[model samples]
Target: MTSHNPHGHALASHTLPGHDHHAAERARSVADHAAAVVELLRPLREMDRIETLPLSQALGRALVQDVAAPLSLPPFANSQMDGYAVRSGDLSDGGTHLRIMPPVPAGSSPQPLEPGAAAPIMTGAMIPAGADAVVPIEKAVPDHFLDPAKTTANTPASTAGNGNGATVRLPGTAAGTFVRSVGSDIAAGERALAAGTCLGPAQLGLLAALGLAEVTVFKAVTVLLVTTGDEVVEPGQPLPPGKIYDSNGTLLEAAMKQAGLLVRRAGISTDNPAELRALLRTEGQGADLVVTTGGVSKGAYEVVRQAMADQPVDFLHVAMQPGGPQGLGTFDGVPFLGFPGNPVSCLVSFEMFLRPALTELLGAPARRLPLRARLSLGEPGGQLTSPGHKHQVRRGSLQPDGTVRLEGGESSHLMHALAGSNVLVHIPAGVTELADGNEVEVWML
Candidate 1:
């Protein structure tokens, strides 16, 4: 039977033998379904699921606890420049000549500066205890450091001054100049990173600097992806009449992987309830969640709904465009989500339901970036209308001038348009008509 919906689209229904009419009639709001998904996946964030991984493998994983610094950065007082280390009092008489002592290269310790004497200290070299200031080599008379072998230790400033002498002229400067004090960058025992921080390159670098070879992070959730439909075939196979390639498998798998979830494809299952039930029981053994695409609608060949009718699952319609049919519940003791078959609908369902739920529950994948931009009609005098009772998600390109222009018509099968879009423009459930320059919420892809 077919009936016209409020939006003037034909709503087709088919009653298959042994179908549960109550499941097909069930409905839910998008927010309610989202919350249910979060609740179902909450166990993945439990403490027992956390893992201790090496720093090299911890990138993009959420840190489960605070990482305290083991030691202060730099660890010691050092020179910030390659210059002369001297006591400020030695140059008290305006500019005075000082005997050049041995040079202090980086990583080498040096003795305290003698009275009225200076030492050539290289950058990052430990500063002697008595030296309180450093004057760059360019500020000195010769503007160059003498070889440490040629310079004598503890050469006095008054010894035989003049050309080729051990003494050199120096300028007056303040104390504590060009010195890198200990704990300047980060103090010891300080919190380097707090809990729930997504470890990235800079965070991992800090962990390495803190002498941490490994870190504790939340374990990635394992998802069993099952794309159902007898008409669905692999991409490499020869196309049979009235059959289509299985895009939901690749599309959803990539999306889940990008969100840091380990995905295992169960291949394609025909519209046989007995076969799908056996497949789920087998493949969902160790999976944290089971996600299926297609067969959740009110059609006679809805394989997922037919197979899961006796299980604890709900087949419902959400107040949304292009992707309204949804399935959420437990199957074979694993959390399950059934998405629409259309490629764009499957992706949108993941983004709207699973992605946010993961962020809220697991804290691994970061939330999508949201922005508000003026809506730009693609053509002159073009107007867009959204169902007042359903939230509309449209593909759009966020322009440099802060306007979001529609990429294609509001259709779920437009894969090319989805690829070209940089953002998903949101029209709220209460909104109906929108003109150019109207502000709309957009989520960055």
Candidate 2:
């Protein structure tokens, strides 16, 4: 009862007996594989691979080092009101009429105020040297600032002996009132942002305020993606009998890109071990990692296992359903990962293994949040039984009422069911069955 895919490669359906026979050989724990991946990519986090990117392009990137404020915010002492800048000593007893100097608008610096003179100042204007406080325009007698256009070019004298027509009556004001002192917001030379801070809108805004046009961050990992299996063909092609459209390539590529990895798809490879090996050699030269889907199972036509046999790849099974078959190792000095061909399995493998490792090492593609939710009545709790030896990751929808409903059955080929899921329910290997209203751990996608 041997079945073949369109290209004459042995299909898994025809080799189920062989898969079961070899499932136990070279098996690795999920935890061990995750740690291995993290170790493999640890070198990519080296300081030599850091990139200096412009503030505009640094969003979502983690800072490589601490950034100090180049200058104090509001760099200079300035008035906070469009009113009169006066020496507090002048208005000691009560309200008094004082000679008004030329108006100082925003972005302008003014001369020192005389002992009995007030300078008409606009918001954000620099305070005169002798001024200690400001009176807002509304609180002043005239309730307005002097018009700059009306002031004559002849420099008015600050001496009380000279005649100055413009005068303003201001109430006694306290020292340091309504003034933005130097370093009021942030002091110069202080740490503005700490290392490993993820650059978001507010962070980039702060960097811009710090007068930094660029920042240093970790470089993105470049992945070479290759999908395998003779039964698979790209979309938009006329499908022959027993052939299926390729979804693993698009699925894994999108997932990797969304995780902030620079992905380069090397196209699909067939069941020929020599062809796959040659393709990896040609395309995996400059990549930080290489990922291939399918051909890692125990079937006779397991091309990835066959091609990577002499390359140090360890093809093994993880204690998990849907995505139990896994492969990891190096191909010509480049880190390689091989996942199963099923679309759901491929995606789940990425979330379970690669994403967490990337988040831990490079600090990109923020980690998925783990939460606990009760099973809803709609969920088939009675039938949700998993083997006691393997951890099960089930697709589920988190309801608005804080409950989770299973999206599909345990089969890994339920692509549409996975599409409708918003969370991944985790069933530990020790727990064999779940009941309605039981609290379960889930990862928010």
Candidate 3:
């Protein structure tokens, strides 16, 4: 069940039942094969340990420890508005008048109030020692000072009696009015942010309110990418005869970036055995994982198989359209993943296999784009008629009302089809036909 690559490397083999022995065995089922690959890679998975990071750098990072408030929010009974701070006992239904004291601005120490007097206080100012309530400025009358010219002309008998009797009146307010008490929003030692939670804007604000300047979070992983093929050319280059632009490399790198992996390198290797082997050895040095697209099949120019002849390479033909070929093994103590060369196939393989496993390893939630909808039209040739394998993926999209529309021709080489699609319709194998209106499971892109 083993095959040799050009570099004398023995690729891991699987036996197909008496069919084209040249072609790799189709997987029994796409889901089964995907699960098996995840199991195989479980041991090599690693997540960075937690580190305390400043608040400025903690955005979008996963929290590693629970955060508790060290002190009560507000920390003291304070004024909520610019007004008069007075003792509650001085608040009478008929309005109590008290001599006005000096103004109390915010950030200054509270001045002790006379037993029945009031003090003018600004918003956020601390309440005086004897004050229990605040009455807004609108509720008080301003005192007029003496003016010699006006007073001299209006010096009447009644004015003289009431001249020195001028006093300010206060409105009736209940105790504790306009006061933000200590621990009103949060108490000391209260749990503010739970462990393992992903920090978002609101959470970050709450942490800041709790006086946290730093937090501990897990580090992101790093990945190395390799795409192999003799006919593949970099983008931005003219497509010469007998060669196609490399799409899988960019596609895989973007996908890995979305999964929180730092893509260290994305280089291409031609179908040369010696060059591929040397590249693998050189790139495997600090890479946690090495991913390759194309040249793992039984074709003669399959450079990935030819180059790593001495290393372990599992040639898997999963039961899935567009993404049936795969290679999984280790190269120089680093995990290796190989996918088919076709652009659509590479993306499909990533969505179906790598994403879920990496999510589990990184303690991230299993996030997938999936939708349920009725088929827009009848796909008569849609089902897989194979006897052994059971699962296929088809490019699809959702209509405005949730109907599923199949897009593009079912060719693996068609990158346009993959690009235009927003979903992957998963149809189980052995189902000969699905009627036009049948409900189906769709994975969103």
Candidate with best TM-score: 1
Which ranges in model 2 have alpha carbons more than 4 Å from their true place? 1-27, 74-106, 110-185, 370-386, 398-405, 433-441
> Which whole-number lDDT from 0 to 100 does residue 34 have in model 3?
68
The order of the candidates by TM-score, greatest first, is 1, 2, 3
For each candidate, the alpha-carbon lDDT, in order, equals 0.84, 0.82, 0.72
Of models 1 and 3, which has the larger lDDT? 1
lDDT of 1 by residue, 171-230 (tens): 898998998888888999989898888887999999998889999999988999999998
Whole-model lDDT, candidate 1? Answer: 0.84
For candidate 3, lDDT tens digit of each residue in 26-78?
45466676677677666643344557888888766667678888998888889
Better of 1 and 2 by TM-score: 1
TM-score of 3: 0.66
With a 3 Å backbone cut-off (N, CA, C), the pairs that clash in candidate 2 are: none
TM-scores for all candidates: the values are 0.82, 0.74, 0.66
Query: Which regions of candidate 3 deviate over 4 angstroms?
Result: 1-50, 65-206, 364-366, 378-388, 428-432
Candidate 2 overall lDDT versus native? 0.82
Cα error of candidate 1 at position 399, Å: 3.8
Single out the weakest 10-residue window by summed lDDT for candidate 1.
1-10
